[model samples]
Target: MSDHTPSPDQAPGAPHPRETVQLIGQDAAQQAFLTAYNSDRLHHGWLLTGPRGVGKATLAWRIAQFLLATPPSDDTGLFGAPPPPGTLDIDLDHPITHRIHAGAEPGLAAITRSVNDQGRLRNEIVVDDIRKLGRFFGLSSADGGRRVVIVDSADEMNVSAANALLKMLEEPPARTTLLLISHQPSRLLPTIRSRCRTLRLAPLDPDDMQAALAQTNTEVFGQTDHLAALAAGSVGNAVRLINLGGLELYAELIAILGTLPRLDRQRALKLAETAAQRGAAEKFDLLLSLIDIALSRLALTGATGAAPMPEAALNEAETLTRLSGSPRQARHWAEVAALITARTRHGQAVNLDPASLVLDTVFKIQEIAGHSR
Candidate 1:
């Protein structure tokens, strides 16, 4: 299915998309939304929170599908949830289902970032968009029951846009449901967070990640165990890593780890420069994963090998592990890891240039490696 297209059962102006989202280990959360639909007790606003790429938007679309399936109330756009799975299977062949899939529902609406004339992300959901939302939801529900407006993510809203959204949260219209999808709830205004019933989505487990990766049918360079360790519970990141030449990068990283002891300053500088020239976020993530994998290898070697890792990677990994009695070199390597993480987070918040950040990390890592010698 096209990423932006509505599901076959969703229509425009409707609150829910017609798509069927596969809920993974989030039964309680799904049931809460389902219960709200069943009882017509749906809140005016809902906050969907979780780490990035763990299916927040997918869940929102599921709720949207449910809303579009039922007619609206006089002032509220609410719907009774369909019966239990055994009782009734929603027929996909219905005309209404197709309409919803086309995003033609009058009871549903969604606001998300769109590219502007300059071809860059608008960066914020604007007041104009919020104002339009107010106008749309204020109208009587065409189907005569409930109206829903889903902000695919409230986290992207700038200060003004957020304030405008806050106004609606302050005095939401009757019979209207608001679904705000957010990866980072802390970034949103506390007032906004306090006003809504929040449903948190948990990270996917390693098994789930493996299943997802298998479905993608891409080659994973490292072992599944190693990739899972580096993935840190993000299926989206794993998928990206697999598709974007990650296997090659992992192989190169392994080669580097094996050779770091004999690696020269000039060669390290070249590698650092190469890393820095790549986008900072991408390079840092790759480096982080590489470091983690190397550490694991070092630990394994120390457990079985007669000699520790020749004071090259072993010392760095020991310090990075933060164990007591960690050597000075290990601590230095750990410090470099910390710096990369901190800068990456900061760059995301302030929109710093990624290339520059990558370069900075490379130079620092080179210096650390030199010191280890």
Candidate 2:
């Protein structure tokens, strides 16, 4: 097995999506594809739509492995052989699986954002990246097998890239399959979406999430419940939260928020200073994200007349209720969330002082809460 370790910036101990063989919480999608394949009505293109990190890529790989490994069913008209495959699994030692693990499969092509001259991943998948598919399709399949193309996320494609892909979907080649993964399907071109068969994956329930985490060998033994709540059923999000110490930071945030209307200047200043330290950019960004989540929860609680289930800390539920019990207050916090989100993005773009930006956001929240009373 080739190395499938994630990068330093990625979730620690988590394998790449392609390396994940057993998909959890996606039986419906698996069964759908099986039905299509067995009935010989499988479409050329598949759109996997769901929230981030719910095993879209894993399912794509599974399909690709099955397609490449399994031969096309013969039309012997009842007396040929056994029934069609009910599952996507291929033998672990299959040559196709090994080739895919090493990314050496001639019949497979993956389109994702490429690295620029600076050695950093590009912000979007450009047209040039999509153009490479022409060469990929130009070559005949090595063993006269099916050709597979995977776009890890269709949402990251720019207009030109998306248009380039649309052309392929318009006239796909024989025995070729294209799998497009998307976190937000609405952001894609309507024409592209309409052309593909969609398979939507829902967030995993707690039991399924725990099973998924265990399959990945994630060691969140005593904290599965907390991680489940914070991650909102995304295994990727759960891993990231654990790696970034997000739970602890969020607890500190709720602690500060509990003193709302009067806002703890000393504690707030300390948190801001910590985020402003050199080489703490990720921490700073995480802090900003946590703040937005807290505000969103506050707004949601007030809007729904239901207390938020405590995720970060035990006092979070009471804190949310105390600060935003009325719909009017909820509206105010929602507006504040919007403003702070915009402000924080703009500040980061303009290279504003991180410490100052954090302070400003807290102060704005405090101001809103004070008047909300």
Candidate 3:
């Protein structure tokens, strides 16, 4: 693949996972893979499963680098099989690292959603995408070295693609490993799931999220605790929040929510206009998601009788507490959130005016607030 070729596997506004040297806050997953490697129980088909932005792909790539660079345990050198390597931390200067970085690593293949005949990227991994790995297996097999293929993510594989992959898992080629990254493993064929050993990645907590964000070139501004809470432990989400001015937008949302039944009309309009602006499609999407988050938090606050801590935005606790004051109010907010979500989808489907849809959604929430009172 050309270095410039767009990859669906890459998170928006974040560096390619392969480019990330460190996998933050996933020590357990790392240790799991390492344990397998050392015990000589490394599965031919490894499933890297986790939520988005939780370093699954990074772990896969790290394993790929380790396998390709490290000699087989049986192949004792002059030093007689170094006592089973402890960590997957390969040196940056390793030749395999250089080749992998250059996208010229023959032993590794990173599969993502492929481009169609029309030059547009397809939404699902087709059979052809999975079959293409046959060539990778054949060509790399000649070297008699470990070959690794990463499908990020296997959940996006269509039925045909999934079945094709299942054949490989059932009868894998010698000295080859297939790493499948999946956000939702349940979507995979049961047979496919059965054949692989799963390495589950976890969401990064605030401190780890901070360290992970540092590895990226994304400039840090505003409170990271807020980012951490809003992102739900996903580094990918945090990076998106930062790049899209989501933190500030969320703060403004919290401030608006503080007004409750009588919302700050001018501020509301400004927000809607912001989302409706030409070339603001991504931001508009982010706004809808933030609204969903806000409603959810509100419902949880009322149900639990306490606001979620380290608030996603300043005064968010106050707003959520004020609006969702009782169990009845919480139930009402949940019902409202459902209705607004339905309207949001319908509005998108029909390509409704962004500003009108946003204003209408806000109005509905305001109605809920009034009813709750």
Candidate 4:
């Protein structure tokens, strides 16, 4: 995705329009549809599954782009919603493109996390969002063609939300397409999984990441390789790293790792204090990034056989970093992160004591480290 979000003028429907994020490694997915189109086999519903930040939503939109504009007679005589994948050449400049991108296409509907009245964003796709799918797809296509509804990610739907969606799946509307995206498909109910054709999208390749970064025109990070590797194959993460000054933070953490051994207790505590002031979410991301940097450095150190930096000090830093990133610890970290974000959403409500939270997190890190050793 480009760090340069389209301006109101460039963006259709002006302000608050959905930005077009670059999608990577969808050739197989695209080909799957092509094969189906050629074979006259189209499923009514599809579940696109992959890790977070992958292009599930983007792919869903692409599919929508095809359905909204393609001629109705183009259906490959298929019984279900989707006719043939190759049947639609999705043009980004199409008039219907604007409608789909603006999320106003009558033939297409999208379910995603929406901001709540309290200003905090809803993490879960609610039941109401799913219920709308039926209404969106149940009616005949606006032009008497195919109708589509996309759940940006089915994984976020709670039990109620999932059930609401299940009803629509059981008795699908004719000439309707249901595209459900899932980051953690394993977490979704098997019944839901069984109802939809599953398409798994893998992480982007290094080449894909490079191409996307080039398109974004992000010159700030001259180290494309570093950024790509840091992104872990998600263009979203790559853009985030560039726009959020993540590179500088990672570099700082690298420096901290290099100097941890020689650092005195006062210095460590001072750094901790600064982190404390960052509040929970920032601190949590920092902690994860710090650990990631430490692990990378460890690999580098092991490979280069450089003069051993303070082993004990590096050990201590690694311990703290690991605990901060551990799954067991991540549970607690998430609670704090969620609370802090919720508070921030509520008028930047800063109720929790930053110092206390940091102290507790660090102490937990120490405990994890001790156990590991």
Q: Which stretches of candidate 1 lie over 4 Å from their true place?
A: 1-21, 36-40, 71-90, 94-96, 138-140, 213-222, 261-334, 341-360, 369-373
TM-score of each: 0.70, 0.93, 0.94, 0.70
The list of candidate 3 runs beyond 4 A from truth reads: 1-6
Q: Cα RMSD (Å) between model 1 and the true structure?
A: 7.3
By descending lDDT, how would the candidates be arranged? Answer: 3, 2, 1, 4
Candidate 2, pairs of clashing residues: none
State the local distance difference test value for candidate 2: 0.85
lDDT of 1 by residue, 1-373 (tens): 3455433222222223235425455566787776665565778889999876566776776676666565444334345543433211245776656766786767778788755665555767777878888567656545456677888679988888899988888898767778898888999999999889998888878777765555445456546764564455666566655555454565555445444444444544454554556444555556555554554443444344322333222234444232212354445555556665676567657866544554454455545555655
Over 118-181, each residue of candidate 4 has an lDDT whose tens digit, in order, gives 6556778788777766566555445577788878668888999999888888888777778888
Which 10 successive residues of model 4 have the least lDDT summed?
A: 8-17
User: How does candidate 1 score on lDDT?
Assistant: 0.60
Tens digit of per-residue lDDT, candidate 2, span 250-291 = 888889889888889999998788789987887888889889
Candidate 1 positional error at 60, Å = 0.4
Candidate 3 clashing pairs, residues 3+ apart or interchain:
none
Give me the displacement of residue 227 in model 1, in angstroms: 3.2
Per-residue alpha-carbon lDDT of model 3 for 31-143, expressed as tens digits? 99899888889899999998888899899999999999999998998978788788898999999999999999999998889888777789899999989888998888887
- Candidate 1 least-lDDT 10 residues: 8-17
